[model samples]
Structure formats: C-alpha cells, structure tokens
Target chain A: MEIKLLTEHYDKKEFRFIEGYKKLGGYETLKKAFSLKPEEIINEVKASGLRGRGGAGFPTGVKWSFLPQNGEKRYLLCNADEGEPGTFKDRLMMERAPHQLIEGMIISAYAINSPKSYIYVRGEYNYPIKVLEKALQEAYDAGYLGKNILGSGFDHDMDIYRGAGAYICGEETGMISSLEGKKGQPKLKPPFPAIKGYLGQPTIVNNVETLAAVKYIIRDGAEAYRKYGTEKSAGTKLFSVSGNVNKPGTYEVPLGYPLMDLINNECGGMKNGAKLKAVIPGGSSAPILTAEEVQKTTMDYECLAQMGSMLGSGAVIVMDDSNCMVDMLKVTLHFYHHESCGQCTPCREGTGWIHKIVSSIVNGEGRLQDIDLLEKIAQQMMGRTICALSDAAAMPTLGFITKFKDEFEFFVREGRSKVKEVRAHA
Target chain B: MFKLSDEGINFVKKELARYETKRSAIIPCLYRVQKENDGWVSPESVSYLSELMELPEAWINEVLNFYTMFNKKPVGKLHVQVCNNISCCMLGARELTDHLCKTFNVKPEEISEDGKITISKVECLGSCDTAPMMQINDDYHENLTPGSAEKIIKGMLNGN
Candidate 1:
C-alpha cells in the first residue's frame, strides 16, 4: 500500500510558507513528541524499522545509538545537499514543507540531547535555502529553535550552512567537515562523526527526509507508523521519478510497493509507443535493472540488494526504448569525473580513466577490449576510497556497460549516439 | 590603503578585526569581499586576508580553490551558472547550457565580450522538481526550456 502520509499537504502551495504550514497541523507533532521521553522516541523509530532514506538504508535508530554518551557538544546535521543524480525528493521536501523539517529537527535534537543543529544545504538551493532560512527565523521567533526550545529545558541552535556546491558533501562526515568551515570533502572513518566530528565532538547526521519522518514516527507511534509501508521498511518514502515518464515528479509510496504500480499507476505510463528499456532503481549509484528485472523488483532495501542494486536516495530513473544506454553511460561517467573531489587516489584517478575510456568509446574510438576494461576498472574502484562515493561511481559504470554492451559497441563502431542519431529526425 | 565601497570595506574591517589573533579570514572575510568586488574572488583581497587572519597564504589558496562558488578567475558583469548536476542533467540542462552559449555566442566555459554573460557548469541547484535549471546572478530559473533560456538571457542583456 502506498502511504502519502508526509506528502499529504504537498499539493497545497501555501505549505511553502510558515502560516500555511502551521494551519496544516504542521508543528503539532513536536508538541506530541515533547510529551514523550526522548528514549521512548528513539525506541519508537527503532521499532518502525525505518531505514535511512538517503541511499545507505542503515537503521536510523542504530545510527542515533552510535552517538557517544560522553557529554560532548553533540550536533544534529541534516543532509539537505541532495546531489544524487535523479534524486529531487529532498529538495521538494525542503521547498514545499520547510516547517515540517524544522519541527522534526527540533524534536530529533531534543531526543538526541543535541544543542546545535545545522542543515548543510547545497549552495545551489536558492529557493529551498531561502525557505528554510525563513522558516528558521520563524521558529526562532516562535521560541522553537534558539535557547530553550518551547521552554522544555532544551537549548538547540539551528542554522542553515550553504555548501559551496560539492556533491561529496552529501556524505554525512563530509557535511561535518564543511560545517566546521573546512572544504566539503569526506573525512575517513574509525572516529566517525559520532565520535570525533565537527570540531571534535559527537555528531548525529540524518537526511532531511529522515529527520522529518521522525516527527511522524513520534506522532503516530511505531505501530501506527508501521500500518503504512512494509514491516522492515516502514513509513512512506518520497521517490523522485524521472526520465521518459509521462508524469515526472515526486511520489510518496510505501517501501515494499511494486515498481510496476509506481510506473503505471502513479507515472501515467511512458510517452508515445515506447516500451520500458531499463530502470536505475535508486539514484545513479544503484545498479541499472532491465525492464524484466524492474518488473520483478519491489522498492525496498532488501529486495534491491538481492537484485544486486540498492534503494539509494529513492530516485527511480525510468528509461524508455528510445534511450541509448551508451550515451547515458558517457554522461554518468562525466558527472562522476567532474565530482570526484580529488580526496582519495582511487576515485581521483579511476573516475577520470573510466570517463576517458567511455568518452573515447562514445566519440567513435572503437576498442573491443575497452568493454572489459570498464568492468575491471569499476571492480577495482569499489570500496577503495575514503567514502562510498568511489563505489557510487563504479556501480553505474559497471551496470551500464554490462546491461547494454551492444549499444556501447554500436556507439564505438559508429560516430554518433545510436539512439540520438537515429532519432534525430523523429 | 585601497578603498572598497563604504559598506564593503567596513564589512571587511569588521571581519578582519574579529580575527585579531590570526590573519586567515579566507571564509568570513570573503563574504564581505564578494559584496565589494562583485561575486568573483579577487586575488589581492585573498592575499590581504591571509595576512589579517594569521594563517598562511596557502590557506586562502585552498579555500578559493575548493568551492565552485568562489570564482578565482574574473567573470562577466553577471555570472550565469547552469546547474548540470544529476537532476538538472537529466532534465535537459545540457540543452539550456548549449542555448546560452549559442545566444551569447560563446561556449559553456566562455564569457561574452560585452561583459554581460559568463556561462559555466554548477552542481545541483537543489530544486529537483523544477529541473533543467540555471542561476543568473543569484536568482534561480527553473523548469527551463530553450525558449526560456533565450528569454532569461534577453532579460539579463536588457538589465531586467
């Protein structure tokens, strides 16, 4: 069953502002959450089995549990820097429902005993950042954010820190480095943000969607929340569906909902007479699934993982028959190359090499063995970096070349993109 | 004893005065610096900042180098950044970029001779629902088509 719980008020344009947000029973959840014990709040989230919606699908409560009890100046950071290819749900959440996220962050910060919170937004998010900043000012005026929020004896300071437009900052630790006024690059683990983070203090980073969902989790209780979505992946998730779809926008669906239902019922089907070609199940980082595999797939972490892909960042990229896989691969490789951040050597060099090889192939430099080189290089790049960014680059490269080898071969043998060149007249 | 604007130099001095024990105001310093010398990061400002913030000049070099928002090179009167990241990339940002280049008679990386438009690729603009986006000056134009691109360029050209 698809639960439009969080997105219930999205269609209302007034929800973009404060008064409209308040009218929709927006910050009421924080009042409810405040009455409950903070530990009870964490337990409720844990019971719901809500995984991190920001790609990794890690247990959110487990992540909260990782925060050290050492009385350090803990921080709650919201990853609003939605940079994943095809993932726009977070942006929509921020723009349409700013107060919801603010209320959620305050509740979560109170629960985690964090006194300072920052929403590390992408520098490019002009409207959402404005909306969030405006919402923050309103919250501060309402006595919800600064110096003893709601007079619950909780002191939390909130600010919106603009990222200088780095995709790597979407990573939690990388966000911390950026918030601490450093370059937006991912720091190594061992002393994760939970330990030595953001000026050497314990920090708990959650996605904007994840933090917002916490409000719902606390309001409805775990059981009621579990009424929607699957038992393992409870609650509704906002998926930004794009590519060749008739209705391309954000849709709120339950975790275990079938992919076909989402495509046919929600998206209004593909354009023209084009049949489904492939689907990048979750963002660009997830492995590409053929049309047949998409039919068999359920939109969840376990199912996607079983299918050798992931439910990353909840972006469903639907490709149609007219799309050329090889050309898309060239674009994807180019993006990874441009966003490599030059942090680790493997990602720094591998992204460039893969891009060069792919560009050469797309530009009609045919090499029979270049296909195999792509797979081998992608394999070597996996898990050999400071963050999963290297693997994110590798996953799509391997998926594209392996899933659509002939199209790549055709591109190399011919001088132009097989699909684009063929459809030039059409 | 060079003078930026009244508000601009005061902003810089305010930031410069706060970091008394140090001379590396690469970041807090640049906020005011950007207000003074348009949006572009001037090399001389950064050099002066390094001495004021008590940090090495390399610190300024690194901050200016790290982020795309900090334009180390000179830009046109209005710097136009077309977001070519994933969401916008899929939503025909490449076409918008191409259109801007053609209209301005420049490339994606090149600026027009009129010192009006400097087109470049930026990361995600964070407005995914309204994709195919670009930022002219500081305002964002979203859900853009080729015609919209032309209209925006025309508006900027006419100082609208």
Candidate 2:
C-alpha cells in the first residue's frame, strides 16, 4: 500500500500542528496544483477514476465537473461530518492530519474557483474540530487560504462548521442546509449540490478522504496515481474496521485488495477461535455478507456491488458466530429511525415501523407475518425519497431479514435472542 | 453565573470572545451552558450567549428556541438518549424507547418530576453492534432489554 499518502504522517503527532505540517511538505502539492490549469486537475481526477469515499461512491471528478464554467463565487464544502455508523476513519484523518485536509481543500477550491470553503464536522468530534480550527488559523497565517493564496492570486477563505450530531447531514445537500444555519435535512434533488448548494451557489461537496487525496493526485500525475489499485478503482483506500476482531482500527489497503487478508492480517482475525459469521463491508448502510461471501469479495466499489453489497464509507464490521444477526438488525434499524431527519415520510415512519417489527422479533413478540411486513416496509422506503438515506436504511434491513430469517424467526418463536440465549438453553 | 461548570464557562467565553462581530460560537456556547445546567439553557445563559455572539436577543432566542438538541427546558437528572437511527431502528430501539417513556411516566423529550429520569430519542449513537443502545447521562448501555432497562433504572435510582 502507499504508506501514508493519505495517512503519510499518522505516526507523527506533530503533523496535527501547523509547523509540523509545513515541515513535512504539506501544501507543496497545492503549490504544484496552482501552477497547472484547474480543468487539467479536474480531468486528471476524472481519468484516475477516484470515487467518493463517503458511501455513495459517486465519481469525484464528475462531481467537480458539475460546477458551472462561469465563476459566481462558488463554494467548496468538505463533508467531515462523518456520522456514519462503524466509521471513524474520517475522524482519524481529521485528527491526525488536519492540515492535509486543509491543503487538499485549498487545492480543490483553487481548481473549482470556490472563494469560500467550509468543513462541516460532527459536533461530537469536539477534539478534531478544535484540531481543524487550529489548523485553519495556521493556514490563514501562512496565506494558503486567505487573500492571494501561495502567491497564486487565488483568494479563498476556509471555515469549520459544526453539525449538531445528525447522520442525514452527511448527505451533500443535507450538509448545505446545516451550513446555511437551517435544520439539517435533505432537500429535493434535480439541483444536486454541484449545481445549487450552500445558499444557492455552485458548491462542490466532497468527502474528507476524497479531498485529502487531491494533493496526491496533483503531486503524482494521473498515470502515477493509478499505479496501485485496479484500473477502474484507482488509488489506496482506508477501511475503518471495527467489531468482534482482535485488532479493530483503521487500515489503508489498495482497492481490490483481498477482503480476507484485511480481516486476518490487518485485524488479527476474530477474537478467540470463534469462526467468522458475517461481515458488513461498508457502514451500517451496506448489506451484511455471510462469511463465505466476504472471503470471495475484495475491498472496492465494483467488487462489493458484485457481491450484493457496497464499499460504503469503508467501515468494515466483522462479526463472529458469537453475535446475533437478529440483535444486530434491530440496532441498525433503530439508528436509521433516529437519524431519518423527518424530511422524507417513508424514511421517517418506515424506519420506526421496521424497528418496531425487528425489536418485537428480538423481544419474542413477533408474528410470522411480521417478517413479510419488514420486507414490504423496506421495499416502500427504497428509491421513494429525496435522498438515499431511505435506501441506506432500507437495503440493510432487507438484507438481514432475507439472509438470516431463520435466526430472526428463531428469536420470535422463542422469547430470547438466538445467539445469546441458545448457548444458555444448551 | 456561579452555577456553570468549567465546560459551560468555557462555552460562554468562547461565545463572548466573538464580541467583535456576531460570534459563530453563540449557539454552541449556549448549548454548552445548557449541557452543564442539566440540559436547560437558562434565560440568563441565553443573555450571556447573546452578548458573546454580539447578536441581538431575538437572534439568540431563536437559536435557543430552535432544534430539540439544544434543550431550553430543564432535563431530568437521568438523561437517556436512545439511538433512533436506521441500525438501531431495525434492532427495535423504538419499542424500547416507547417502553422507556411509559416506565418513566414521561413523554419523549420530557424530564420527569422530582428530577428522577428523563427520556428522549436521538440520532444514531454509532454503536450499531449493540443496537438498541441508550446513553444514560454519558454512559452507553447497549443491547438493552426491558428487564435490563428496568434493572439499570432501578440501580440508578438506588444510587448504584
């Protein structure tokens, strides 16, 4: 893997500081980028084929290309509001290399001609916000952000906007609402954030990882950047692996890397001798995979899709036989219900209804018909909304209920969780 | 004034530091004070935040009034934050949340009398593995059962 292009100075605590950042060649790539034409940089990104690291996997270059050709005081918004469940890599990126994101943003803003930029961070990331705010002040002092950035004559100002702990705000449009000081809810589409966003200007909302990698994209030409990963999914990706593992932390692997290697080598395998049961390759939004399927999969956008799952936010949640799918599904459903933002009715109500059905099954009050009811509620919730939050909520529920129905039914028939209670019953 | 914790005071100072031009730290500062004051940003604290952000009382008041996260009303001593996100929802957090409200004898977001307990539904707590988790005043109790919920509440009441 590319040791620390994104996580280059992770071992260095000083990298979190401004002086340390400059010493380690931070903003050097930005200086190189400013010399080249903005369109050239965007084209390079497109050619590289780097997808959005935040769940949706939208084409990063294409998202940038959506900006209007004419300059109208555009905005560059960094989606650091990493509120996805099972994801902490963004938080680590922000905390460990705050200046890297700042430098990347400056480069990206320069390319997009966005005079103003904001990093919408999660409120609970109080420390990283402090780290970033500190870094911004340093960037301003260095003239990397404010008037005449790096003598390139590009005037850009960057700020950190804290989100009030809402998961939906992680959505690009939802972030614009929060940045505009409105309730963090997704707006109707047709005017994606690229066309209309953040006070109705041409705004480009890129994920933290996507923006941070821009420096590397500029430093190494598109050909150089595509050297590591598969042709379609170029560049290294960071996977935040958590749950039921001996080593639960963030590890960077090239796209198309073996999923089994990630679990066994990077994570030190499952805790104890317990056999692997299932895997959630992405955040809670992605479908759960049985152990056999996870081994056959690779860590990337296309590979995951082929496996009937997604490489969402790269939050790898590994589960052993000790865990209960029924108990887990209930948790996933409950999160979607709480964070639905009440903007879309189906997501708002359907999430709660699904949670009710799942919990009833878990609590042993479920009826046989409720399993079908779960599928119906999920089907109605999908593709019938303004944003994909509904789909994110529904797809996982459908996957769990359909894949592990026996465990769920077993829980319903017996008033106890199958995984936990079955051992006692034995 | 004398009652704010260090965090609340820091929030006020953070807000007040913006006295030059309307500070952006006002709402978060007020939130900090409310957080310290057992989930109620008092009128006095609002005034303090207003002066800090250099914003008018009307603007500060709207911020205080808006969003359920910033509690203007007094929260109960035992603050319970139930995960209502998709994962937790699929896991049955709603039923347990409803169960909590019934058992506590209070509506969602309501702080019970005598300051014994309060319950509210909140965004995902990120602990999806132990779905159906609740954050009680800061400590997260995951994989909740009604019986376990009752036991925990009883223990909290008995000062356990």
Candidate 3:
C-alpha cells in the first residue's frame, strides 16, 4: 500500500498554486510550526528521526545541529539538483508541489534560524524552475516567505538558484560552489558546510524530500510521524521507479516497504512480461542487486545496507532479462566518466580508466585480465577522492563485476551478450 | 560584437540581483545568452557577459563550459537530445536515437544537412518513468517511439 504522506495532494492540478494548496490544508503546518519555539521545532525533528534522503542517509536534525551556535549567519540550501540517474522524484515534487517544498523550506529555515535560503535546481529543469518562480512569488505575496514571515518576526528570504548542469552539483559543496558562481566542484570537508559553506557561512544543505518532510513532522507529532517507518529510517520516502517496469513513476511508501511489493504492485511488475534479472535499488551510485537478492530486500537504510546495496535517493532502476548487463554498465560508466568534475585525480582518472576498460570489453577487445583490472582500479578509486563520486563510480563497477561476473567474462570470451540475441553497439 | 537584446539584458540584470551573490546569476545569464545567440554561447558572448556582469572571463567561461545545457557551438533550431542512460536505454532509447538520426539524415552530435535539427545522445533527463525520452529545446517528449518521435520532429522542423 502507498503511504502518500507527501504525495497525497500531488494528483490535484490546483495543488501547484498557493491558493489551491491552501484549500487542501497546505501551509497550516507552517503556521503550526511558527507557533512552536525554534528550539522546540528542532527537538521535534530530532525526535522524528528523519534521515537525509539525498543518498547520504544522514540524520537531518543532526545535520541542523551541526551549525555552530555562535549566532553566525547560516544558509539552508534545498538540493533540487536531482541529477542522479533514475531519480526524478525531486523534480516531480518541485513541479507538482512547489509550495509544499517552499513551506517545508521556510519551516526548516525558521527552525535553523537561517535568514536566507536557496533552492539550487538543475539547469535542464527549466519548466520546474518556472513553476517554482511563480509559486515563490505567490508565497511572497501571501507572506509565507520574505521579511517577517507570517509576522513571526523570523525574517527569511528564499530564492531559486539554477545550476548550469554538472551532476556533481548535487553534492552539497559542489552546489555551494555553483551557487557562488564557480565551477561545480566539491570542496574538501573538515569544516564541512555547517562550519564554512556558501560564502564561508554555516550552511545546512538538505534534499528536497527531507525538507518537505519537515512540514509533516511538525503537523503530526514526532511520535505519529515515526509510526509509518522503521525505527531508524523514519517516515515515508518517494521512490522513483524507472526502467523495465510496467507502471514506472514516483511512489511514496513507508521507509521499510518491501522492494518486491513496490515492483509487483506499484510498478505493475516487469515490462513486457520479462523476467526480472537485476535492480539498482538506489540511484546510479548504489550497488546492483540480483533478482533473488532483491526478493528479500526492503526499501530502507539498514536493510539495503545489510544487503551490500543502499537506498540512495530512492531511485529504483529495474532491468529485465532483455537487457545486457555489460551494455548497461557501459552506459552507466560513460555517464560517470562524462560527468566527473576532474578536480580529484582518483575520480578524474579512475572514472575514465574504468569507462575505457568497460568500453573495450563492450567493444570485444577485452583480455580476461581486464575484469580484475577494473576491480583494482575501482577499489583504488573508492575513499580516495574529495567526494563520493569516486566511490559512486567505483561502487557500481565493483557491483557489476562481482555479482554479474559471468556477463563480463562471457562478453570477453564471446564478444557478444549471452542474454540478448542482438549484439550490443560496436 | 555579440550582444543581448534589451529584454535579454534586463533579464540578466534582474537575475544578478536575485541571488545573494552576483556569481549565482552566471548560469541564468548564460542561459539568456544561449537563447539570444540561437541556442549556444559563443566566446564573444562569454567575454561580453564577463564584462557586463563585471566578473572574470575565466569565471564566465568555466560556468559555460561546465554545463552541457549551455552549448558551446551553434545548434540546429531543433536540438533533439535523446536520453540514452540506463533506464531510457533499457526502454529502447538508443534505438530511438538511431531512428531519429536516420530519419534526419545525420550522425549523433551532428546537425542534419538542412541544419534544422541536431541529434545527440544524452544521459538521463529525470523522466525515466516515461522512458525513451528526449528533450527537444525546452519540452520533454517522453514515452516516444521512433515513429512518434519522428512525427514530433517533423512537426517542429516544419514549424508546426
């Protein structure tokens, strides 16, 4: 069954506008939130146990607490740059319910006491940006945003910052750099964003879903909010189901929902009645899962982590027996190679090296040793770069090689796919 | 010699002031340049934007080169970007890309001979649920077949 906590009103076309949203009990939570003390609000969020949905699975309240209490100016940045392949839930959230995100941001800002905030959307999402800009204007006119919001004496200004295009910009520091009008590259952490970020001020960057969930946590008490999800991974999350699925779209389910139920029920099972071969439970960076492994998998932080995969960004990309794993890996590797920011040597060189090796294998020029070489290169790339992108590239490379070793070895040995009758592109 | 229209200049000005930092305005300003310069940002436009925004040329160029959306060279009026990432590829996006290129008589990343369209295979465009999709200019055409995509392109190519 769908949990629909955040997406309950998504089907209503009028929900996009402030007036329509208000008709459906929207922004009432913001008012309720404003009535509570800021510290109380923070405490409530901490009690709710909402983790960062931006793939890190970091506890959201803990992240807000990291901001130095020196009364220094801090920034709340909404990570709307949904560049993770197979993930479109954020885009859907912004497009269908911009004000929901806006309300959530304002409440988060009020709790964090940040005077200013930004929604850094990807450049390709021009349509969603347009919707947000209009919704922002409506929010301003309605006094939900801007100075002295709702006369609560908490002054906050929210704006949408368009990212030019790098996938790396999805990284918090990379987004901060882009917001500062520089190359979208991730900076080294130590001070982290809480200590020094976005023009050297304390900044709290949260995923769109994480921020939006703040409203519900405030609306329904922390205890009520905690009831839907698992003990650690509390509350509902929007899983973006894509690839060889019959009904692929964004589905909001409780954190510990069964992956197989989501596929069989929500997604209407594999497309064209093909047998499920594999799945990438999270976004592109998550390790791949075999059909048997996915059967026992639950969509949560602990379950996926225990299974050697992750519930990263909740982008479930399904693949059937019709697809070739090697070809899929080639495409996936090419994306990392193309999008690598080239700042860190391990990610810069390693992404290209692994992509080249995979390309060679796909091109039928692979030696048997190339498979081991990929594993070695990927192992070195992990935990070596300034950001997880090195690991993002390596994780899948390692996952594909280890779990689907037969595909790589067969491709190296036979120069064509063992599953599909047609050969992959030369 | 590259200059934005008065309207374009005004949009850039507003965007510069819209953000906490003027540098944040660079992406929006470059998008304006792309629109004004027929779909791509030129070197002259980069220098012009740098001078206009009072930012470094390096800063402007980095922002421009970093984003795939801000095309560096001229693109056809109809810039057909086929999504060939994992989900889309699983749903015949590559075949769609091939069909588009063949129908237009062009190679991937190359403009058609008549210069009406450019077919480029792109990564995921975030519409994977509606797989085998393409972003032609600003609109996303998803769940497309070779025939349907061809029809859409023909309509756009003929200005219909």
lDDT of model 1, residue A81: 85
Model 1 per-residue lDDT tens digits across residues A1-426: 446788888889988777888898878888887787888888888998888888888889888888877777888889898888888888888888888899989989988899888888887676788888888998888888777666677888887767666788889888776665567688889898888787778888899899989988888888988877776778888898887778888999988889989988898888565799999989888889999999999997779889999999999888887777776776777778888889899899999999899878766775878989989999999988999988988999988888888888777777677777522100
What ordering of candidates by TM-score runs from best to worst? Answer: 3, 1, 2
Worst 10 residues of 3 chain B by lDDT: B108-117
State the DockQ of every prediction: 0.40, 0.18, 0.75
Please give, for residues A169-282, the per-residue lDDT of candidate 3 as tens digits.
999999999899889999999879999999999999999999999999999989999999899889999999998888999999999999999999999988889999999999
Better by DockQ, candidate 3 or 2: 3
Would you give me the overall lDDT of model 1?
A: 0.79
- Misplaced by over 4 Å in model 2 are A1-3, A422-426, B1-39, B42-69, B75-160
Give per-residue lDDT, candidate 3, residue A104.
Answer: 94
Report the number of the highest-TM-score candidate: 3
Score candidate 1 by DockQ.
0.40
Best by DockQ: 3
Residues forming the 10-long window of minimal summed lDDT in candidate 1 chain A: A417-426
Error of 3 at A131 (Å): 1.1
Global lDDT of each candidate: 0.79, 0.79, 0.91
Candidate 1 wrong stretches, greater than 4 Å: A422-426, B1-6, B9-32, B51-55, B85-92, B127-129
- The TM-score obtained for chain B by all candidates, in the order given, is 0.83, 0.76, 0.96
lDDT of 3 by residue, B13-65 (tens): 89888887898888889989998998889999998999889999998888888
Clashing pairs in 1: A55-A313, B22-B53, B22-B54, B23-B52, B23-B53, B23-B54, B24-B53, B24-B54
